[model samples]
Target: MPPSRNYMTERLPSPQLLLRINTLRDRALAADSLNALAFSMANDAYSLLQYHQALVLALQGEQAELLCVSGLAKPAEDSPYLVWLKRAGRWLNQQLDGNQPVWLARADLDPPADINDGWAEWWPAGLWCVPLHNRAGQRLGLVLFLLDAPPPAPLPELLSSLWQTWSYCWQALDSKRRLPRWNASRSKLLIGLGVLLLLLLIPVRQTVLAPAEIVSREAQIISSPIDGVIKQMHVRPNQQVETGSLLFTLDETTLRNRAEVLSKGVAVADAELLAASQRAFDNPQSKGELTLLNGRAQQSRAELAAVKAQLARTQVHAPKAGIAVYSDPNDWLGKPVSTGERILQVADPAQPAMRIQLAVADAIALEPGAKVTLFLTAYPLTPLHGEVLETSYQAHPSDEGVSSYRLLASIEGEPENARLGLHGTAKLYGERVLLGYYLLRRPLAAVRAWTGW
Candidate 1:
């Protein structure tokens, strides 16, 4: 005998099962909403199949939603089974294998494969997966029938027919209430076309964007030679001063007093030595005292000369002709600074370069002579072009506390208005790439980081 005949003869649906399926079909036809339709269908399947749970899942975009659940303790949306159901539904919808419904039993599936094993813990013994479709033969959704015992031989064929009838009823009712819409196939095709157009037409630049500031190439820093308070500032900030001009001066009162004290000590020691020398001529015993006094006088003279040199150094002078680059001289006035502390910088206005701080997340492989374009905050309309001079190998924290790599770029041509300390945005260009890759590069990198790929 043929398999179909043998299956039907062995396990035909009981009269009660037939009656329940008829009732379910009538209810599905009369269902007002998609939710009501799914619930009625699941209820009928649970009653006839003697299943522990029955779930109806519908696919929307990249996700699947639990439309209705029967034999569940709580609402379908709040059930733990909902999570697994949605996950399983997505995979099932994407499957390209044969469309035949699956009847899985624990005995038959000793070592379950694919999605069957995933839900094995919950279903444990046996279950049936019935795929539903619309009139156009497009996959609409799936109906999951989970049972504690293995189903009858003909149960798969019967349940498949019943689920098909339920789908037809849902379609008839839904069509009357709603207008026609594109199926999954049509929507996917449209999206593919849109993506293709974007890839062909869109122009995306592979760039490393960073915060840049105008810096002087031949900048000379003026540091505090000695720890002292500033008494007076001679040149104003950004002022063009010649070499040897007094840039600033420290309070010389203490230094002068120290010098004076040293000088007095030196004079006294010299007088003592002269007296000792005269005594040595009269008494030979004074010769040892004369040597001691002479040594003391030389030490005092050396100390005094050193104090005088320090006193002269109290007045700081400009090293070379350049503009004084400082914010406010008043802030530095009376401020006691430590030795080697930066007081100010003298930068040549003629030589300017762009200093870029590239964020760690935004860093890319950079090489010397790579093109860089800077859009100054001051001059938004104008863009100054440059080329990369060098990039720091190590990453360090920026003033904002974000780790970043430093890049130095030499401006191609001098922009007349660009000045030192001008802030701007810099775009460092790298190798050309497809528009799709350029757009998805960061997002893909983030995904890779999250997944530890």
Candidate 2:
């Protein structure tokens, strides 16, 4: 509660105290570090003052961390005595100034009950505190010595001179301890970061990968002309065929059965009309009925003709000479198809083009006539190059189940080397952008999607 006791105005110490002060001065000067000097002041240096147990602590952040204790190599921080000592150290750190030393008893501290309860159990009398200050007058740490009895004459004068001797060496070690650890790597780190930034700024062409296949530039889609189950496939995928060739046929059993029923009804109508004509000559009532029978007979013939025409359409034929492109014939053998459902493609194998399905998420602004590179799974070594001819404005679900934009690219030079229906990976190039943008585009897009930014 009171200011630190002032001992500077006291008379000079006697000869015996002078020799003791000089002995302590030699030990402080020879000390190598703050920890070593603190240890000596708590242990061997106790001859300068009468004290029992002692503690050496460093001020680290808001806590007084134990460094050493008298008669022990390491301080037992978990022990009840040290735990109570730490609580008392916190109160002392807040109240004491580094200007002078102070003697603290139980009433002087009036610490919290937790710290107060264990003080009498650990020490017999009062505690003496000496704060260590750097050259800048900042409190570095403190030393606590437990004393049961009063120190002999001239103890204050001797302790004041001893503090001056220890502070000089403590300041030198404290300065070195506070320096930056990575002094050697700072220049190398700065150079690496600068180089990385420049590399990111370099301009590069933006590209995207999409599944592609070699197809005809002008191909004909062969769709089902009637609603029926496919009975057979006459042409296979990539098979050569000519005009008027049977491409495929639907199930004719249902149409054939309908035609047979219509034919029998037509014959019965003609027989009834003949019988009514004969009766018309005998009775006037029969002549009126003869006209009705003739109309009925004509209607039956029309129905038969319609059924026959449907039967003719069951067998489909190729309209042009080209190769047929479709999947496994077994997949369509018993599958029911609707009218206008596409079954296969009739393409000219020599005039190959690229059909690329670019996913909507990976889509970039691509102009017509943009460069395209195709690496076929079969012919990976010989990459075929092409130019974009068309790109769909809207996205459609592809076979891969992802929404994609369909792209058609025209093959450069002769396309005879490549065949239709060959699958590959296409590399489509767009306008130039910063290398950083090209590399980080997907990651940045994912982050935006996650953050909704």
Candidate 3:
């Protein structure tokens, strides 16, 4: 006889694992209290396996009642750690049904905010869960081992054996048990489902809110007609003005000085040509000098006329009768501007329209003639209605650096009430869509981006 042929002993793992399992099992049996045993099982199991943390939850009344966590003697019931752990345990219970161990990852849960998106921050990348079953084959509790690295090849099987034995002892020590599942009335369940379906199917308008401002369709933009420094602003911002009303002026000192210098040069050339003509009547050599002097006189006069033209352009004026729209006059004062650089807009107050900046992230399918409602920031209660008059095919960066599409909408009623450059939030309505799609559109898009499916 060879050591009495113990089949159970031979079926056990290597000696190292066997010794570790036996050690944890002895500790579980040695506990004198339920809390002590729970702590031992929650913490002491780490000596036999490699894991960063552990969570032990007991099944109570169809809910996972968290008993203890590794490395903590006692944690408050309402602590954030325990709250999130309980949610994880409930999700694990649903995942586990048979008397076996399972590996779970973030992808399996598709965690919501309640479960917290920062799963990896609190837990480890590698997760192993053991669903503890009673001798009657009913799920009694759960054990979670979080690992930062890969587990040993024999880790799961050995841990399973040790967990099964400890769990059996734990159930014998504790009095609470899992409640059996209940079946509700079929009529009531069906009615609730029908109501939920009807609610989800309700039609709702697809809407996107974007930053908007009251703009003019036919406004004349007053720009710097020449490259010069802004000298004066004749009309205040949003001030009423008639056609040819002075709006602003550039620095005319430089142009005026240049014109004066050229005018004097023309006078000098005329004097020189007249002297050359008087000398030409006396000597032939003076005749040649007269032609050159006459050419210089004509060139100087042409330059003087050009300088006067620039001096006239320094004073910008309103092209059409309307309100002047621009930033603070102080900001533009002493500011050098290039020719054709926009300084202000002369917009017709009676023909105000909405200019919406729809961000790329919030952009929806929009076309001309779409319905729009603008709620001014100052007067949010009274909304101005409009229809989309034009939409840009491409996206351009807004002042805030957000890429957005430009939309022009016509104000239907009380256009006179809407002032040019007034800021507001525009709600652009699209074709009617199901309520379910309207609500879940963003969430589904996020999930699809995450899963690439």
Candidate 3 per-residue lDDT, tens place, 1-453, comes to 566567766665778767878898888888776677779878887876667888888887569888778898888998777778777777778877677787777655666676645476588665787787777787878878887655666666666667777777877776544365667799989999999889989999999999999888878877888999998888888899998888888888888899989989999999999999999888999999977998999999999999999988887777789988888999999999998898988888888899999998888788898999999988888899989999999999999999999999999877445877789899999989999999989889889989999
Superior candidate under TM-score, 2 versus 3: 3
In Å, residue 199's CA in model 3 sits off its true spot by: 5.9
- Candidate with the larger lDDT of 1 and 3: 3
Better of 1 and 2 by lDDT: 2
Candidate 1 lDDT score at position 371: 94
The true-versus-predicted C-alpha distance at residue 258 of model 1, in Å, is 0.7
Candidate 1: stretches off by over 4 Å: 1-181, 184-205
Q: What lDDT is reached at residue 148 by model 2?
A: 69
TM-scores, all models, native as reference = 0.58, 0.58, 0.59
Q: lDDT ranking from best to worst?
A: 2, 3, 1
Predicted structure 1: lDDT: 0.80
lDDT of 1 by residue, 171-271 (tens): 66656767777566878999999989777556755797789999888899998888788998898989998899999988888888988898899999999
Ranking 2 against 3 by lDDT, winner? 2
Candidate 2 lDDT tens digits, 1-453: 123334543555667768877887788778787677777777876666667887877887779877778888776658877777788788878878647887788866677777777777777668777888877788778888888655665677567878877777677766677866775587899898999999999999999999998888868999999999999999887899999999999999988998999999999999999999998888889988887999998999999998898889999999999999888899999999999999998888778899999998999999998999999899888889989999999999999799999999988888445877789999999999999999999999999999999
lDDT of 1 at 432: 75
